[model samples]
Target: MTETTVTPTHASRTGGRHDEIRFGTSGSTGEARHWFRLPHQMEREVELIGTRLVGPVDRVLNYAPPQHLFGALFGQWLPRIAGVPVHQAWADPFAPLPVSPGERVLAVCIPMAWDLLRRSLPVLERAGSVVALHSSAAAPPTAHELVRRAAPLLRAHEILGSTETGGLAHRPLLPEGPEGGDAGPWQALPDVSFVRDAGAPTRGPEELVIRGPRLARPEHGTRPPDRWATGDLVEFTGPRAFRLVGRSSSLIKVNGVKVHLARVDEQLKACLPQTECVVLPLPDDSLAGEGYVVFWSGRGHAVGIADVRAALRDFPSPSQIVELAGIPRTPTGKPDRSALFAEFAPTSA
Candidate 1:
């Protein structure tokens, strides 16, 4: 392995019809581990996304990194299949879109990048029918509204899934709704099926077991079940759709009370509508072993811990409040959670 590269576990053999490439997890804990994917698996995933989301696209405007699932499909695979040109929007954030009016363009971007481009949506108004797909991380409904309002003809889709699952589901968010308004249950993509695990605890939310061709081959030494039981908790709204409760892993105990980190994020965003927040768990020494830390950003808006605590009386209080220009994120647009956690986590003595 190179100095900058740490090799992930996988087994591959070349030459002949037996050609296959496998990818390992980025190091998961305990018995549960991520699966390996073959090239065909990747191809099948891209096909599903292109058919359901990027239908007959003439060009791809990719602003996300090629390493990410959303970006790789748009930047490379989709463009290859569509015989269309791809403009590297990440190369120049403010540069004019390489698109014209009435053209079909699949614009792939992330939540953070969208926040910046949303301001310049007026310029993209002339840029033809853009099917803007936001993924990698959750995008606030306001971000969708901004783009929808600015580009009146823009088609918006929020793909809900991870690098491990490809794209499990996608919801059409066209014409955007109010900031705090719920968009309802997410409709699962074709070729995917969901099952509620029977072994999940009754006291807390339940886990959803997903099984599909787009999924990875069980690699870990664990029970290697046919279906992957994702940590994402959900409440069934319909047969094919479900409202995401939160990740089971995101649950923490505070003062003997169960607190959902996702709920904390939602409440903080609701209280401070203008500001963006990322709620993190820190080591609590007192009654609760886990203390909550809130990181928020509103540009020019000044938000204080006391004020936020006042706004949220029904929720548990945060042990700390950190305000910054914006939430720090990884190159792939995922929240730099480890960095955020490290900011307050005590260093070794």
Candidate 2:
């Protein structure tokens, strides 16, 4: 997606009088789709996030472009609600934030910005307080550690939702234990609830059917549905809390065995916390059907193909483990799977 210049008029405005606010879905899976939300729907979302997720803030250092849902809500709406100034220069993930000493900052960031923020620890420590908001992907373990070791006032939060659902659930990015990062479940936001998908099997991971006030309407301007069936499969850990199992679309069959691409990627990420990698399914005649491939970048680290293979010993070995200088990503910082497949699938085959 193209980045739009942030202006004072654009940054301070809210969707108060618009007939419907249109947002483009992050084109991580394919072509971007358009969704619409009523002005009241957006106001309620901002209210919930502002009251529950965000408190008073001196200013906002927004690292996400306003086009993305998370960016629009937190980067734009939240600061406007709080009547705080915003710094959009930090929108570039790699750029150093302009946080000043004694200013309580609401650092709106996407998942990809965490690593770059980690590199700016000294600069971050100068702030009176920092609340880092992350979305568009899972927050890396490093982000949790960054919060754990930073000034006691530093906090990191992760939001789980889509452009269509706005902000459905959130959880703090706590420090990882010796075993691994905190695998805690996400708590549904106020006025939001979910259940197992009706068509799902009685056992195993089930797709979620979410019901909430934040649901966006179709771009055609119809009334929003009472419930939204999401593609994400999850396991209920408690009332109003659940851990993501994976996405139904991401679950692929390989040699008659079920493999979740998200789960595989998570395990690989666990092993190489600093290295960037993704697992994708590919056609394989020898395997009798689809097989998986690992696309990884050392990112200046000494990680190797051997290291990646060693980490996947328990799972089905990837047909190919290719390393690149860097992983391609969408404007929202999600891995551009279509681009990756187009560039590498032919060579892998």
Candidate 3:
């Protein structure tokens, strides 16, 4: 899907709510799709996420894609709910910042867009500028430091939740300590609870099951959520705190070793500059099982298959690494692993 445009109206200029907003999702395992949210729903969401997190803010500089969850909730709706000016753009990160510094401003961002914006931090920070940067979709561990250095006053936030449950929790990205830093105590949204596995002693490496108002009913004939099983694997730090590992389906078993694809890709991408890579499971016809494969996007890089092998010395040997024009990406800029793997499926003998 491509970017969308919003028009100016009396409601927009006078700080009234945006009557309609588009919500899009690249399904858990396939291409992207979009839906339209009416004014009442948009207002409810704006106040819901805004008052909960930032609290009665006056202005927001929206940069997150309107189609994404966090973007639609925080970036687009938050300002309207707060009755403040909203500066938004439907363009690439290369575009200039819509609002000036030294003003109380907030922006919702994803990992990729955060990385792109951090590239221009020298121009982003100001005396009274308070940047509430919320990152979701994927953690921007790679861009945390750049964000801190560029905007000293920036308070980077990582939003934890799905479209179904709204924003479940938030953690800040601090300057010192862990690279993918976290801030604030994890607090559950009102009326939301963790649905634990029946057999587990507590929430430990269990799926993120949720029960809440935002949990949508099954649509398009989709399967109903048996208590909204998130399929995301998480590890608990406390009764209320948990760190996300990855999606349950994203975990691959190789020779009895469970490998997190995100971890493997992070290690490989660290070694290869400018190359964005994605790892996926491909079923082996001969082996009667599945193995890993990586697809990367970039040019003008000398890194080859052998370099990748050496970089992945500690990692398991994937079935293959097939370089392509680009790693197939969903409309939301996330990798389309299932589609990519099918492209390389072995032919029947």
Candidate 4:
């Protein structure tokens, strides 16, 4: 999906108890989709997340932008509920200290923020106890490696969901844990329920259908009786825990064999986390169809084309492996796939 833009700026700027803030969606389909969230919706979110956070946290340090859902939760609703001083310093790692010794701080962070914090963990860790929260995208192994190195200095709580789904599940990580650097199984939020749809011949993986009061309604003006199907395909590990297998919309076919982009992403992340890797379809001149390309970014000791190919040997290797100073990101810190493809995609005559 493309970067989300706030709609009808008036309500977003002047929020009311029941006022709705609209967010526009632009994805593969050129058509636009709208999602509405009211102040009460955010309040419900703060109440749910606070069950695990509030009492333990003395202050809220939000680094996410206040416009988006996750950011609104931490930057606005959460602090309001806790009645604590709120701080926003997503760009700077040291935006004054959120807490002193013996006090706990609930810090909202994305993977990018953690990347910066990893370099100065010693000082940050000494400041106080932190319940570091992350969302928007999966935390890279490199970021987890940093947390593992800092052990006990801070605890990472990775929340999994999108703008449409307020908060689905979250997994806890420490400097040291059994799961380590891999993406561990996630437990669904207390109020969220999940069901898997039956697999069809055209589908690459089974999709997870969810039902919760917290999820946003569709802009198309249609509302299901109980649930909404998420784009993600997941495998249940236990009663409430599940692991993401792939995304139904992210499949690429090569000579009739299906390859999931999510699998490629996982393989690349397992092998190389210093740089972010995203697979985009390339033009296949011979077959008059589509091929795949691996575009990545980062510097210093970055992964080379040869290494990426070797790691993805078990899977389909892209036709090209390109690197940049950084991966293009959306306002919410997700890989801007549409933008990346446009910038790096090979043109055909």
Highest lDDT, which number? 2
Query: In candidate 3, what residue range of length 10 has the lowest lDDT sum?
Result: 1-10
Report lDDT (Cα) of residue 54, candidate 1: 71
Question: Residue by residue across 1-349, what tens digits does model 4's lDDT show?
Answer: 2235554323433332235667666453235666766666678878877787444577777778766667777877788777777777765556655455666777787766776666656556655576778887666555567667765767678787766778888887545432334557889988899765445443335677888887765565433236767777777777678878777566767666678877787777767756667776664567545557787775567457678778789876565677777788776677777777766745321
Residue-level lDDT of model 3, residues 160-193, one tens digit each, is: 6655445666666555423233333455666567
Q: What's the TM for model 4? A: 0.83
In model 1, which range of ten residues has the least summed lDDT? 1-10
Q: How well does model 1 score by local distance difference test?
A: 0.66
**Global lDDT of each model?**
0.66, 0.73, 0.59, 0.67
Task: Tell me, by TM-score, which candidate is best.
Answer: 2
Q: How far is candidate 2 from the true structure (C-alpha RMSD, Å)?
A: 4.3
Order the candidates by lDDT, highest first — what do you get?
2, 4, 1, 3
**CA RMSD for every model?**
4.8, 4.3, 6.2, 4.2
> 269, model 1: CA deviation in Å?
1.0
